[model samples]
Target chain A: MVDVQAHLPVLIVTVPLIGGILTIATGRGWKPWAWATFLTGTVFYFTIRLMMQVLASKTGMVSYELGNWPRQWGIEYRVDALNAFILLIVGGVGFITTIYAKLSVEKEIPADRVNFFYAVWVLAITGLLGITVTGDAFNVYVLLEISSLTVYALIAMGKDMHRGALTASLRYLILGSVGASFILLGIGYLMMITGTLNMQDMHDRLMSVPGILESRTVLVAFAFLLAGLGMKMAMFPLHMWLPRAYTYAPSAVSALLAATATKVGVYMAFRFLFTIFGVGFSFGMMPSGLVLLLCASAGILVTGVTAIRQTNLKRMLAYSSVGQLGYIVLGFALANLHGIAGSVAHIFNHAVMKGGMFMALGAVVYRTGRCDIRSVRGLGKQMPLTLAAFTVGGLGLIGFPLTAGFISKWYLVQGCLERPGGWPLAAVVLIGSLLAVVYTWRVVEAAYFQEPDPGTPPVEEAPLMMLIPMWTLIGASIYFGINATFTGHIALTAARSLLGGAP
Target chain B: MTGVLGIYNYWIYVILMMIGLYGVIAKPNLIKQAIALGLFQTGIFLYYISMAVIDGGTAPVWTTVQDGAQKFQGPYDNPLPHVLILTAIVVSVSVLAVALALIINIKRRYGTIEADEIEAMDIADRLAEFHAGAAADAVDEAAAEGHGLEHAHGGHHHG
Candidate 1:
């Protein structure tokens, strides 16, 4: 057990990587699904174990160098309180979505391609986990490309359903490649100055080097990294590719990407800003905080209103995702204890909420074969459980009391009140919630009040397979919302460690 | 002037990258966008490869002395960046492949790879879907109000 514990990080990534490629030989039908489920389940178990080990370790950190080589020359896999929390979120969501995906994939994708689909699916999850676990900055870029390529393929798979999916995927590929190149350029600049790719070593070198922090090269690197990550995370004005991609992708893909992809982008931002750059250089010497704060605030308002205007429910939630990400960015940009903690907590909370909501939408598509506002009219009678889950998830999005979103928002508001001239940001949060109410209410009213179309065929509730996973996520959100001790504790621990507090 | 001339490769890379970016943004053809993306990545690859160069450096291959006591050498070009760019080149090729595949799919589906034409087609599809949904709502309203009119959209199938 001790030996296995030491090798957990690399094993967690490699198992899925090998397993995903091997899934292609699984052939068709339920074979690939079963293989994927086992792989994801194993990964999820490893994540939980790693999280416990991180807590149990002396320094709240664990480092494993490849092939027993020295740290400077070899790649390392580092796990700390911060990334352990993120790994748990990604792993847990991947496992749950894999279970939900079997039914949804069959309904959506063609049979011959199902095996390849699952292969790419697991590969994408592997890339996400790999990026979260690696210590080398160059490794981050490689894994990022792995994930982006797989995601582009995944979104393009939706072309059979709608031709627009083709365009959406192409647009994303072009933009995503540009963003990735910018990141590559940034890393090149950093390597030129520091002569290292290890993140912690880079930080130390930056500190000891004379006047390097003020240099034009380092500044350019910072700008490029920030812009690239912003585009990846769909920050405000850079979020154009998101709505259509989510709207057109296969349902399970949407749930997986919505829950995990952008959250990982935020995680990368945290690493670059807090871990490598240090809070002093990032927030003090640089004007990034003020810049991020403004973008996040404007994103919250603009995306919230735009979410209300979307005719399709999936598109609406996609826009809401952009808006919710704003709160997370705002929380971290504040650079205060409560603010960063709130950011961390919301990562978990919003994952559960939005993951559950997207799963519910998938179920709606499964049953009635449509997801527009009109198809759900009078769906309350036909699919009470699914719509109820959506309604509750929407309430969580509005930060209603006794919901997980409320806990994060409460911390965020307290964080705002902690700073002078933060009240305006607080008001923006409130107004954003109000806009959420309007959009969510649109769905609830359509489902509950209006009559079902007499012309369309009658529908039933979603299959048991789909409902179970959807409710599991929704139930976890509510459970964590009421008893915030676990999430709050982990989030605060991660936040404190990020701010250079005692580990 | 010497300082600027010293880094001529970087200047060329910048020019190539901007031109590629311009094509991606300004061109309306899907295939052109894919080609432009490749050009843009090639510029970045050039940046990485050029930065790895030293004034009078040799290949990174090491040669050992007969006694193995003087096995070290000075002024070898950095191999790490070249290795890194090799992986990046693979990534770029895969991206180009995917982009071309998607372009082929767009051509198959819409019969045109022009960006504006695809946008127009998508908008028209959405408009038709909106009308169908609205027409369904009208039928529902008519039924609820006990109106005699039953068929909406003149017998067009709703679902």
Candidate 2:
């Protein structure tokens, strides 16, 4: 192995953690942002390298040992095709968010504390990377907290500017900590049963443990993991804190967290369910599938309706995020290859689309200083650059043809049809898409057709620094939609790998 | 009897978890909720620490021995769970710090740590914004009408 290549996994995460400290050392100002952006960019490069190396590997896995200890005794990073794809999404978004944060934070937050902003930002990015790359089961909990704690600070930072941001941040903190505690509880149960913390070793041991099907310990562990991840991902009923938190947070942080945080939670669900517990235990040994289906369907229908009632664009999009998660969960609920494929595809597509859209909204806030729908009236004529980006992203979010979202929903529909008596499932998907159209159209109509606001002063385009990053994500959303060769292949590989071996 | 006694520690964790969960769900004060969150996390910490102990094992430190001396060997308690719990405890502490910080900021902004009052404030703010928007629209319409009338008067005078 090349000398640099051998250190890729740890470097991919450590680069940002160190950068956060370096940024703190530099003190608050332009220097912190400069350090953060450069560090995030470096991590982004390493993340892509790790992805390529994993893809190129004959075994499709990259294992990096920490401190050179043996496998079971060491903290190891196991990179597979599944997490590699997630790395691309997380690292890529972190990089763009860093670039966008400079101008966005300058507008929304005070200048003196900008260093603190980038410091926490780097920590958040590293936390996410750590969560994705770690192979040890217990390491996931630590990494999960790394991101969750940073996220709480980031959200609360919005309090200085927005009135309710602190309350929203507090609610998220309480709920998020609860979620983390539950996950730790679940991990404890798994450890007691298997006597190992290494994920692969745990899987091996779990297979040998008798009475697993009827084991209440195993069942309770499963329940805890489900509820814990549900809280983290804001699944259906456990989603009250999300809309307020997203709406009240600074726009740049919103884009970053929206694109990556819950995504890590979703990835954990896949990792623990299929990779650790065995698919049969998660699906067949229990009635998890039916329960997931019911919750996902309700999440789709209910959140879709709720999103329509929101006046603040950010909250609307936030509720829309909940509804979108429903689709991803529905994929896993189906427990088929196409279903898993759709789930992974939406993970990529939705991240790009939401990143682009939220960043555009952030840009709009930078230029206009308002978030209500009315403020965007005739913004198409004034802030055309940001508005145009928002339009494409919104279109993709609505599952329009030639958009990333359509491909995801298409595969998801195919997944539904692959099951017996599946038309009702398919119908719900269609209705959700139509509901998305309504929300997207609400924005489009307000921007393009509503009478131009006479109360607000005219505004120019957002700065080039912000526009460039936003457009890059927007372009990727379309680029992936048009050419799914790379993403589609990876998604299929990941799905097959998850199901390759059965009990 | 030994098996039953062995299970009591697990029951303690369960009860602690339930108390934390109830506090998180039912507590009205934001700071209390944050503390409840910490307590909930502590339950997990307790579970992990308990898992580290083995029935007849010593602490996982190495003891020096003379060369080739025949001695009884016993297993050491698993150190990994202790290490894991230490990390989790750190996480739990940091979570508390962030939660308290957020509550402080919220109290500063809203002047109350009560969840209900804060929620009430939020509703009032939204209502206020709604009315403000309506008033702004009304004023804009009347100004437009007044401008149109002025243009008409100017045309008639020119004619």
Candidate 3:
């Protein structure tokens, strides 16, 4: 057990990676799905074990150097509270989505391509998990590409449903490549100055280099990194590629991408902002805090209003994701303890709420073959359980009391109130919630009140496979909502460590 | 003046990146955009390679020192960026392949590789759906609040 424990960091990533390539050989029918489900389940177990080890470790961190080489010369796998929390989220969501994918995949994707689909599916999860676990700066870029490339293929697989999937995938490829290249440029600039790729070593070297914060190259690098990561996370103005990509992808792919993709992007942003740059240089010596705050505030209002206008339910949820991510960015940009804690908590909360909501839509698509507003008409009585799951998930999105979202908004509001001259931000959060209500209400009214058109065929309820995983996440969101001790404590601990306080 | 000219490769990098950016944004053809993305990636590759250079430096290979020498004569260029860019180039090629495959699929489906034409087709499809849904919305007026407002104006304006 001790020997296995020591290799947990690398095992968590490589297990899925090798298993994904192996999945392509599983051939046709339920075999590929079963193999992927088992692989993701094992990965999820490893992530849980790794998280337990992180909590048990004295420093609240674990680091492993690859190939038994010195840290500065080789790649590293570092796991701390922040990333351990993210890894558990990606793992849990990946497993649930894989379970949900079997039915959706058999329906949406062609038969011969199903095995390859599962291969890319597991590979995508491997890339996301790898991004969250690695400690080397350049490795992040490589893994980012891995995830991005696999996602492009996954999104394109939706072409059978709508030909628009091709355009969406292509647009994402172009913009994602540019964004990643910007990050590569930024990292190259950093390496020129610090001469090291290990994140912790980079930080140490940056600190010792006098006035390096003011250097033009460093400033340019910061700008590029922020812009690139912002685009990746779908921050406000840079979110042009997101709505259509989510809307046109297959139901299972939508749930996985919505739940894990941008959240991992936010994790990468945190590593760059807090770990490598340090809080003082990032917030004090630079103007990033104010800039991020302003952009996030505007994004919250704009995307919230835009979400209300979407004709397609998936596109609406996609827009709402941008707004939700704005709240997370807003939380951290405030740079206070409560604010950063709120940011950390919302990452977990939003993943569950959004992932569950997307799964609910996937079920609707499974039943009716489309997720347009008109398709869900009178679904309340027909698919009661599915619509109810969607309604509760929607309520969570609106941050209704006794739901997981309220806990995040409650902390966010407290953070805003704690900072002087922060009442406007607090109002923005409330207003954003109101906008959520408007969009969620539109769907509920359509499903519950309106009559199904007589011309269309009657639809059945979603399969048991879909319902089980949908409620698992919805159930988690609510359970964590009422009992905030676990999430709140870890979030606070993560916030403290990010601010240079003792773990 | 010399300080600015000393990093002339950066100037070339900037130029290549701008040209690629312009092509991606301005060109309406999907194939052109894909090619432009490749150019943009090439510019970044050059940036990494230029950073690896050292004046009068040799390759980053170790050589045994002669008997008279206390240390190996060195001034080797940084090879790490070269190695990093090699991985990046592989990623770049994969992206190009995916983009081309997607473009071919688009052409097969829509019978056009022009982005503008494809977008026009998508817009027309959405408009058709909107009009069909609007006819039904007349039965339930209250439900026509959000998506209907914009598309309603579009219908009348287009008519």
Candidate 4:
């Protein structure tokens, strides 16, 4: 008999991989195949949740060695609280996005491309899950590139079929590829030094290497990795590709990439910083923490200010995503237990909140055929249910009470307050939230207060398939906000594990 | 002197990287920008290959004819970096192909590949539309003023 629990992590990744292949092979004639792919994602989520319970119950980590090889020589897929928490976020959002995609895609994408879209969608999810669940450094880069390549293709197939979509996707592809190369080079350099690609072995080797502490090569490697990953996360100065891509991509693709892609990048950044480099060396021995802090602070301020000025609703949300990523990076830069915990929680919280918001926007675009502020005028009277979902999502973005966004910001503020020089960081977080309120309110104002144009026809609500998933995310956002213990407990435990602790 | 030559190779790679980056940043043409990106990627490949070079190292292979003897006499150049860079090269080309396709599409839709031109066109369209609305409203005001003047004159005649 197979040890099912031991095989769960690989299954989490493999199920999606096989489903992607099946989706492509089945072609457009089999709509059920796409649903099966979606069902696989849902089942994968349940399996991860079960694994989380197992970890919580045993208070231990699960490490699966590929091909029955030893830890140092062979590839390993390790899952602890940190990845389990992230897996839930990725899988959960993926499920909701897939469900939302069913109807939203029918309206936006051509029937001929529908099956291919689902195939690429599942492949992207598989790549992301693979990146999260793996223990090999080089594998992470490969998987990152895989997901990024598929995303570029998916985004380029937007409704406009204009060069803008293609151009934006191209820009993202170029930048993303360059970033992945840098990460790979850095990993190669690490391998040269340690003679091992296994993360834990590299960590142990790096501890005792003489003169590596002062080696310029190592420092350059770190810099390259940081810059590359920063681009992937759409960190401030490197965020030029995001707005156009989000604006031009198909609505469902936008929702999925917005919700989960950058979060995966953030996860990789954390993995490299805390696991491979070791926190002591990353923060105490190098200037990485301070550098990340400065960049993140700039990202928060600049992106937040810029987001408020955007007239297009989807582009505005994309910029808000940049600002939100800054918050997560800022939390990571704090390098304390509370700070790390907050960062982890925000990963889950932001994914849900942003996913829901983007889905609502997708709903509006589906109904009105425009995502511009002026186009959505009098939407409250026309598409009241869709507008309600948008309102909930907007409130969440503002960190309003009884919303998931509040939990993230609260923990982040608390985390910053606990540090010695954290007052400034705390102030930046507060200012960012206030700016979020401004931009989110801008959309809400246009949706509710503006009068409808005289000759325009009344718009109907989004289809049931779209509305259900959007509201489910919105409701979950509110539910988690009220009872954060579930998210909070896992985040705390994950943070501890990431910091290399038993508890 | 050989060691110095090795160091000089790295400096060349650095310069290449900087040039490529400058092209990516400064060029306004999208195709040019893509080429620059390609250049940037090639520069990294140069760095990787340079780092893997060894002193009089032979290619990594084996000769079965020589009773399973290794091919290299001296320290063999690291094949790992070469293998890794091969994968990277493929990925870079894939991206370039896709980007080029997009650039072609952009040219077809926008009729130009210059970033600035696209921005200018989009801005001009908006500006012209805005001013056209204002001009129509101005014409309506002038007509209303003329009609009011005629009505006043007619009223005076009737009195």
Task: Return the interface RMSD of the candidates, in order shown, one decimal each.
Answer: 4.7, 11.1, 8.1, 14.0
Best to worst by TM-score, what's the order? 1, 3, 2, 4
TM-score of chain B of 4: 0.70
Winner of 1 and 2 under lDDT:
1
Q: iRMS for model 3?
A: 8.1
lDDT of 4 by residue, A1-503 (tens): 97766677777777777778678666674483466446556656665665566566565667789888897767798777778777777887888788888777777777787888888888888888889888888779878877998898889888252335766787788788778878876886787677778887787777788777577767777888888888898887888889889977888888899888999999988888888888887887888888888888899889889999876788889999998999999988888878888898888888888888899888887776556676577888888888888888878877888998888888888889998978999999989988988988887787799876544458887889888888888889899999999888878877777677222
Candidate with best DockQ: 1
| Tens-digit per-residue lDDT, B1-159, candidate 3 | 469898999999999999999999999999999999999999999999999999888886756666655544569888889999999999999999999999999999889999899999888767766675667556444434445533543332210
Between candidates 1 and 2, the one scoring higher on TM-score is 1
Q: Compared with the true structure, what per-residue lDDT tens digits does model 1 show for residues A307-336?
A: 998878999999999999999999999998
Best by lDDT: 3
Looking at model 1 chain A, which ten-residue stretch has the lowest summed lDDT?
A494-503
Clashing pairs in 1: none
Question: In model 1, how large is the Cα lDDT of residue A67?
Answer: 86
* lDDT by residue for model 3 (A399-429), tens: 9988899999999999999989999999999
TM-score of each: 0.95, 0.94, 0.95, 0.89
Two-chain DockQ for each candidate model: 0.42, 0.30, 0.34, 0.18
Off by over 4 Å in 1: A501-503, B63-73, B139-159
- In model 4, where do residues sit more than 4 Å from their true spots? A1-4, A29-36, A39-43, A46-50, A53-59, A159-163, A501-503, B7-12, B53-60, B65-77, B122-159
Best by TM-score: 1
Off by over 4 Å in 2: A501-503, B1-6, B63-73, B141-159
Q: How far is A203's C-alpha from truth in model 1 (Å)?
A: 0.9
